[model samples]
Target: MTLFVAGLSHKNAPVELREQLAVEEDKLRELLSDVSATGAVRETLILSTCNRVEVYGVAEAPGEARAVVFRHLCRYRGVAYGSVEPLLYTHLDGDAVHHAFRVAASLDSMMIGEPQILGQVKDAFGLAQACATVGPALHTLFTAAFAVAKKVRTETEIARHAVSVSFAAVELARKIFAGLGGKAVLLVGAGKMGELAARHLVEHGAFPVYVANRTWPRAQEMARALSGAAVPFAELETALAGVDIVITSTGATEPIVTLAMVQRVMHGRRARPLFFIDIAVPRDVEGSVNTLADVYCYNVDDLKQVVEANIRERLREAQRGEALVMREVAKFLTRQSDVEVIPTIVSLRERLEEIRVGEVRKALARLPGATAETREAIEALSAAIVNKILHAPITKLRESSRAGSSRSWLPLIHELFGLGRK
Candidate 1:
């Protein structure tokens, strides 16, 4: 059988198309049944995430399997094949193994090194297992893929840095404070980005959090969600004096936290350090505030710059991960080829042994007076001849499998020996 994967991802398909093909966790079994009903593949697994929808299967005929999977996907999702065909990709055998490893390792993600894809792939595998659709081929493939993913994560630094603006802000805070435990945080806006940054800080052990927004009710809502206190808009300047880290993402047209305001807050603090994360479009904090002796300010652009640098570092680590994945792919392919050819080898040996036993029985029956010693000698001689004759072909088969040329001669070997299907 041949292994294959057919799918479309963020690199090729748009979000709308991906949404159309998305499968809910509860409906995965139904989808697996639908693919099985096609009779195009022996074993199948489906991976349907927001970023990609893929079908990995083992088939006797890979070309037909690929076509069937594509048609089934379009029908299942109610999409036109013509529209999606151009965006779809298929990888066969070794290439399929390579793709599976890369995906599980997060190398093929829209944001490489993100940990969610590995978990998503594992979820798909579990669903397939529960549905009884995963056979030996898919079971081995996915299990090895998971192992390779773990190795990549442990050996490489691909996921060591923050890649988003909110997370980058938190990383900067961690560096400045050496740790986030007990650090006072003030969130100055109720915007989504600012809320996300505050959540990251709180999760990392920031305490005594305060939310200060222009609107009192929104500030109260955010503070309640974060399990913190709401500071009234009138106390914004006073709140600034008490906090160690400040995140501002308001919709004001002008600078809300001016340099003079921060200077005044810093005067009575006895040279305490302050950090500002301004993740707003029109610049929430004045650009000049970063010039203060113990005050540091980073706007949205600055956070993005940090994110970009982190992404570059991830890309460099990804190169090492890619090399690691390729090595694993080669090893998996070698094992797969051996799996494919072992049955044929066993069948051939059993067939030869059966013939040897039958001929030996007939010869003994013809020699009615043959002694037990003579019978034993004839049996040993026949067995040795059979083994000697089989050695060359068996060695060749193993070598061919390792060379990745098993397909070229496997069918002919089966035909010559009248053996079972390869």
Candidate 2:
């Protein structure tokens, strides 16, 4: 398979551009179906997240396949192809394989060693499978990447330190209170980031004051899961007064917690210190809320800066991950190369067998009145000669493949035998 990946990420594009191309969970099937509908790629998978929007595919014409991907992405996101083309990065074949492995292991994440990327990659692969966009080649590629990611995780300490924005929120909370032994936390939304923050808080001894969400049932579910009481959506302001730490991540288009709301909540508390971590992209909490007296607010970018300082602590572990991914890429490439190599060898053997049989028949025909035993003997000799001639090279090819080396022998042997291009 001519595997390729074309996409943009936080490395080149800003969050605003990335979010423009971000594919929501609900629209994945439709987008994947559109990608598959183009007939440019034989197999496809889309990995769209807050940090990156990448498309992986296996196609005969990789250049054309990539163009189709860009076209579909631009059309779906309602941007001109020219608008986003400059932000895109393309990886082909071995690079594509290595990139996938690195991404699955979280080595490519904004927060290196953040574990959530592995689950997110799995989710993308799963949704692709459900949409019937992923076939055998992609399935094998993804499965191998997943295994490599697991191996890297278990062997390295890349994830030993807290490196995510949510964890950074927890760290900030600790710094504010000096400790969270008895701090009250209000999770203003049940989004993944908020849930993660809530878990980290609980793990650090902060108790959830109340879980609030746009939906009451979801709030109830998250509250129950975190061992906290659910607060009705309308009464989030009332719940705000009791907590010292607040983490909010919601999907609302506008801010859900206004400056006025926080100010009113603060009036009742007699100037007690309040901390808010707004992890949502559009920001569930208003920016002006930070201006209120005795209140401190941090957004995603703020938490990222804190996480960035801690990334150096995991760089050594990331080096180990890079080495592991390199080895896996070699193995994956060896397997992929054999998809063509094995068939070429088989074709060469068959071609040789055809020549051997034709020569044997001519030789037998020249022998007048030959017995059946003589004919059988001639056939046996021809078979033995063909097998002996091919055995050494065939065995060497298979053995070298197992050792993750000598794949270059493929083109050499192809040329030596006058085999046509694969």
- Top model number, lDDT: 1
- Candidate 1 to truth, TM: 0.78
Query: lDDT of all the models against the reference?
Result: 0.91, 0.86
Q: How do the predictions measure up, each by TM-score? A: 0.78, 0.58
In terms of TM-score, the best-performing candidate is 1
lDDT of 2 by residue, 1-422 (tens): 48899898889989988888887877878888887888989999999999999999999888788778878877888978897887888898789999999999999988788888999999999999999999988898899999999999999988876677888788777777978988998888788878888888999999756788888999999999999988888988888989999888888889988999998999999988899999888998888888888899999988888877767768888998999899989988878766645886797898788899899989988998999999999999999999998998887777665554545777777777777774
- Residues 1-422 of candidate 1 have per-residue lDDT tens digits of 88899889999899999999897887678878877887888999989999999999999997787777778777877889899888879898889999999999999999989999999999999999998889998999999999999999999989888998899999999889989999999998899999999999999999989999888999999999999999987888999999999999899999889999999999988988999999988999998999998999999899899999999999999999999999999888878788878988898899999999999999999999999999999999999999999898888898898998877778878888888655
Q: Give all candidate RMSDs, comma-separated.
A: 5.6, 11.6
* TM-score, structure 2 vs. true: 0.58
Clashes of each: 0, 0
What does the lDDT read for residue 390 in candidate 2? 94
C-alpha lDDT of residue 106 in model 2: 91
lDDT of 1 at 46: 89
